[model samples]
Target: MPKSRSRHGAKPEVSPGRATLAAACASLVGIGLARFAYAPLLPAIIGAHWFAPSAAAYLGAANLVGYLAGALLTRPMASRLPAPALLRGFMLLASIAFFACSVPVSLVWFFVWRLLSGIAGGGLMVLAAPTVLPWIPQSRRGVASGVIFAGIGIGIAASGTIVPLLLQQNLALAWDGLGLLALVLTAVAWRGWPARSAPAPTLAARAKIPAHSPLPTTRLRALYVQYALNAAGLVPHMLFLVDYVARGLGQGLDSGAQYWVLFGLGAIIGPVLTGHLADRTGFGPALRLAFFIQAGAVILPALGTGTAGLILSSLVMGAFTPGIVPLVLGRVHELLAHHPSAQKQAWSTATTAFALLQAGGAYGLTYLLTATGGDYRLLFVIGACAFALGLGIDLVVGVSLSRRRFA
Candidate 1:
């Protein structure tokens, strides 16, 4: 939905630092803990023989399905409740979902909770950028978005370290422990959120995209497709790198975990660097550079050997994976600035398209991997190709957009 720019209370008083921190906490609880927690834990769950490989794959995917579905609910929810309330509610649900996963019920129950957690993660992601970005100064938006998004890195790093330690006690402890961590993060973020923020406007509540618009319908359609491809491209590394390192490369679990740490470190640095670059150079150019960089990163591991190659590859993939989010969001705002009425429509439409396709890959790739008998090479190859395709489309569309601006 259109990112909320309006304040609910007279002052909408929350310190920028607090707003950013709340946004980061949302990132932490949402995708960070909700999603990445699964990656590190996946091997452990497997080592313990809790479920068959195929079943585990399905469980991993169930969250993505729920995430896509939950994302669809955000704009609708926004029109009904204030931003802060919606965010708060989603955060609570996220924590509850995490807590539920700790319960060691049947596989069915675990999948259900994973799905619910994914849904919460998706909803929070949809709203967080909208909720926080508008409050910061324009010049600082990229950096602030980076800082906010850095929570993902922190979450990944935390999982890489904490999950392994927790698993030593028991799988139940690991899941339960993460749930508690989510609660702690939520509580820390609770007081920082404003009483209210701009509500998402329903389609009926806002001006419709004009029949004859400044941005062509055809161009927008291409952008949507490109976004979907981009979404699909990221799944391989984020979900499978550790598995690939330990299982595929025969590097062992500790080696895989260490590389995962490298990824987390890269992720922590990626957004701020890319955001600052986007600030100085412009989102489109920075995006192009990132896509190309990510293309190389995704392919590097497939080509290289030993710890050095894996670490370098993970570092690159980690940095570019989540880094792409804030950059694209900034580009969306920049592209639609002249068409004020279309801002919400453009952002919502574009992001939803991305979410659905990514969800498709998340759900589908495991089957592909499982069919290939857990050969992750095929998965990364597919991911790299997808990113390459996305980069080509972006380059073409970028040119088309520049032409239109002058035309």
Candidate 2:
């Protein structure tokens, strides 16, 4: 193990536990406050202006495209900056850009700001786990990761509830208010943030391997496939779940919103429970279970329509969807224990691939729905099959990796 030291040659007085939690919260507020918040408020924002709904959707896509770019940028930057500083800077930019969206502006301006927000959002997401994971003890890593990811659920719920309520009073005011709140949280985080000591040179040397290197080639390939498949399955839900309910199930907007509330609530519960389970069993088995549960959840909506079915599917899908990322990251962390450089490289590569897959899937599904004249059932079928395929691949790869470990 590498020796830990303070950056100033003296023991820096700071609480690792508190700092980790704060960082996680700041990251949650940073990345998600803008991205997730926008979806719920898009109708109001567009309604106040003359821009076409399609243009509004394009702006949403722009945000995702920027996220893809940010993921690419994080690869080179993560090693250069202190993780805490990187996170704070990104959060600041994102909050400001989100606030900028309050003004009724040209569609082009909205697109630009959304794209910038996406970049910052993506950077925060990629950096969040890697930054905090090092601070947590090994025994607590699973739980810690779960706690951090729960921030996403919290942020989504906050956005969903807060934005709509604020919009009821005033749309522009709502945007500015949320943005200001995020900014305040960011500043508090900056003040309390602990300084990160430099990691040992040996650890950096170990982590420097390229993605094509033989050591991580197999694991990296498997992870890419897993992420891409999962992303394909999830894109529909993230982008169109509300639309699906409203259009196919004949539910009103408020009813659709309630389904999202259930979804976010499930996300909050899912990670904590699954992380504990993973620690007890193993990541492979836990992941296999999550995949199966998620697959079932995806197909449930297609089966029937009622408040009961909608809520059931929402909870199941929500619980499993966000659970997969952290578990895979845990596996990567395990694999790269001996080689920190290799681990980081592998993570970045996989994350970038995941982002691209998510973008492609979102656009692809949107196009398909449009072409089919709002036939979401076809999309759901595709999503379910994709998830099932992911589950099968996970089982195969997981078994092979397990045997290799024992050997």
TM-score, one value per model: 0.90, 0.88
lDDT by residue (tens digit), candidate 1, 1-407: 23334332224467767888998999888888898888888887788888876787678878888788778888898888887888888888888987787775789998888888888888888888777766676788899989888888888888888888898898879988998999999898888777655344345534564545567566567667767787887888888888888787777777778888888888888888888999999987888787787777787666766567777888888887678878877878777754655656677787788879888898788879878787787787788888889889877876887898899
The residue pairs that clash in candidate 2, if any, are 207-340, 207-341, 207-342, 208-341
Measured by lDDT, the strongest candidate is 1
For 1-407, candidate 2 gives per-residue lDDT tens digits of: 33333332333335556666666666566545766666666555556664665666566667777778888998678779877778888888888886788885787888889888888877877776776566566777788778777766777667767776787788888889888878877876675455664345454444565545446567668767877788788766666676566555766555666677777787677767787888888776777777787788787777766567778888877766566767877777766665665666677777787778877787777778778877777777788888899888877876898899899
Q: Model 2: runs farther than 4 Å from truth?
A: 1-13, 46-50, 201-216, 247-250, 398-407
Which candidate number has the best TM-score?
A: 1
Q: List where candidate 1 sits over 4 angstroms from the true fold.
A: 1-10, 198-213, 216-219, 400-407
Residue 72 in candidate 1, Cα distance off native in Å: 0.5
